[model samples]
Target: MEPDNAERDPLPKTPDPLADWLEEPGSTAPGRSSWLPILAIVVCVALLSGAAYALVKLRKHPAPGSGLTAGQTALASPGSAWARDFPVSTKADLDGVCRGWYYPQSPAATGPAPHPITVTVLDNAFKMRLQPLSVHVPDGVKKQFRDAWQPADLAKVQIVACVDLVGSGKPLGKCSFTSPKVTTVPFVEGIYQITAYEVATGRKLTEARVIGAEECPLVALVPADDVLHSEVSDRQLYDKLHALVER
Candidate 1:
């Protein structure tokens, strides 16, 4: 009889909507949204992407003193070759062959067979002169010397003679010269041999000759050689000579 009261009214039981939704497979739950998980995934992906980009940027532009960007150092030439081995004899030797002088001991497999010749230039006194045989001089470069000599300081100057050789292993021929009024001369197109002479005596400043060769045909006005040896251009030969001189 007492138990019948239970069935009279289960004291106004409240329906739990969240519990009901959870029980249903497809129903949405309270305070639980699908967008939160989607947003979290998107945020994680963005963070990873940002980190990847940072690593790439750091690799491209590294800090200074980093050995990664450093270049190679130059070494001294072996003193076996004639040009590199022989000490410049005199000022006259420097003037005649120091500028636009080239000689290869072995024939280049790529360019034409070099036209070996002996080059010599005598001073006004004719007492001192440059004697460098087997030196190389481009065909059209002689004109550069002529044009350059037309100026006030170089007008009276004379190239005298030039020698060219095929392959010398190292640099070309050794040169010498004598000019009282000459400080620098455009021997071959863009190639210039600067001679710092004593202001009063008009002699060369440093006995250490400075030889510079340029292979820029368009800019230097030096022409390429089409000899019977190889296809090696004057530019290539010039570059080789430049490398040797710089060293």
Candidate 2:
């Protein structure tokens, strides 16, 4: 036992780095460590990586109701809500509107009308039996479509013709070829598909389709005339067929 009057020596203190740091200026109590900034940086990097991955995914798939597919871009007109220019590059691109057997253009065949083309409408509804409408394939329109492809010897080729539907499969009631009665449908509408094939080999050269609601949807099959009044829908339909030579 030490005497009351004797002085006691202080024990040697162990170094406490954490306690020293906590007691530094600007520190109130033990809180987050100095490494907290590094942790925050790691979190930010992870968030940025996730955002970049999402952007790539969005580019791969288009949003629904955008009137477009993954690779397709829409060419919209100012006042025409129902009309759009569709450019198809592959059979897959044309698959939605073209249902019947389709083939790629013949490798040897550069021009669609290297041979004579026969056009026909293939609607078999009972209503058509009473008033069958003829599909007139005008030489002028044919030349326009054929001109889009590489010119070939028009004198050398011969091909067979096949018929396809345009829009709704319903019978097209009487529509005036001179004055068309264009209408809109809430539910069902008519669509027409015009396909061309090589008569000898039955090879599909090209095809296109159009859609509209009209009492006489067959008006689209009629020949275009300068004196004939035309509707926007009818013109759009004709334009589609005229552009068929495009790959």
Candidate 3:
């Protein structure tokens, strides 16, 4: 009796419901949802899609020379060619004619030599360089020259002669002077020898003359007489000299 009941095996104690649910392969608890794995998968896919879109956009807008965009190619071609084609000249002509010679005004007056003058022709103007001889051509004188030259703007004239005795070969105690005697003159539009003389002895080494006009602005000195004369169109000469000097 008591024996039989004890033998019945105290009714197999039922496992805890929560423990059974946890142990089961498939089970849904009160506050738990079954969509966690699916949500995780969706999040992963969304991240991957964003990453792929960014990569595609980056490929389309890559840096220059990346070989993908045409911008780099366009910049490389004609721009480079144009730079290669046109150049500038730096070294000026410095021959004896280009570099001036000296003459004595008075046969009795003896000295080393007068200042060596140089002239440069630019597209819009000409420059005169007189060294070793100091000629204080007053602003009034310059203005007079400009007026005489006529129809040219005198204000733009830039005269820059300095006294560098060490460089001068003249015996007149070496005084250097630079004067932008005239500017914007129709006659002086290009390179020309306006005047060459020794103020010390009043000797004239070269005469004043213009070789080129505004229509054609290139001047080259005649080898024999040092006379100014037009050689070619300024643009053509500029292009040629630009190429040569640039090289």
Candidate 4:
């Protein structure tokens, strides 16, 4: 008594075309490959971010003697940072008021090989009061001599450094001078340092013959042999001077 339609098996069910396409082997649906694109994008972003961070760090911490010395103070040297060591040292003369490597022991300078920089004086105490005088570096080797010197009120004054590329070792000492009102000079391009020390008066330095007569200090603009200067020319001293100035 079953109806023919009921008895007959339902016509083979038609497959959904969409379903067949989705279920088909080796078929690429829209979202199947989404993860790959996302992962690749993430990896590229990470690499770019890392490179950017590294570049920032390099700009923040420039190499020593660059625009900034190890101390973070700007350098007077025109180009990049540089340093040298002097093995031989000059003798300190006690006969005068003050003493140090004030003269270039080498020959005369025809050109500015070892540049002259003017170093301002500061008090030795932590107060670091300014001194009336400054140390002058000449482009040549001549030591300057004057007839008389005015007494500088400075005692136990902070030391200043003139870096000599050809000079070796730390300076043995510093000398003082008196000029009418040479409180400061417009900044010039060169290397410099400031160490601490106690020395007498300007007159003594002049009398001691520590400041060379009007002659160049080195053999040439630079020195051929071991010449004199100070260990203060090194990086540490460069940093200290900058700190003192900034503070």
Q: Estimate each model's TM-score.
A: 0.18, 0.28, 0.17, 0.20
On TM-score, the stronger of 2 and 4 is 2
Please report the candidate that would top lDDT against the real structure: 2
lDDT against the true structure, per candidate, is 0.30, 0.37, 0.29, 0.28
lDDT of 2: 0.37
**Candidate 2 lDDT tens digits, 1-247:** 7567457677789967586346666573445465665689999999999998975553332233333342232212222111112222332322212222211221223444333332334434421311112233345655544543322432222322333443354443343444454533223345555565432223455665555433334444432221111121434434544333332
Candidate ranking under TM-score, highest first, comes to 2, 4, 1, 3
Q: Superposing every Cα of model 2 onto the true structure, what RMSD results?
A: 16.6
Candidate 4 lDDT over residue span 83-145, tens digit each: 211111211221111223211111111232222212333222232323223332223423321
Please write out the lDDT profile of model 3 over residues 104-209, one tens digit for every residue: 1112112332122222333211334332112222244334332321212222211111111111111212112233332221221233434332211223333433
For all predictions, the C-alpha RMSD in Å is 24.4, 16.6, 27.3, 21.5
Across 1-247, the per-residue lDDT of candidate 1 in tens digits comes to 3555755755787866456435565565555663566789999999999998975553231123322221110111222112211222343433433342211111111223121212243322233544433334345654433232222322122222222222312233222223443222223221222222211111222221123343322221112331111122334333333221211
Q: Which stretches of candidate 2 lie over 4 Å from their true place?
A: 1-115, 126-161, 166-188, 213-238, 241-247
Task: Output the TM-score of candidate 3.
Answer: 0.17
Whole-model lDDT for model 4 versus the true structure?
0.28
Report the C-alpha displacement of residue 234, candidate 1, in angstroms: 37
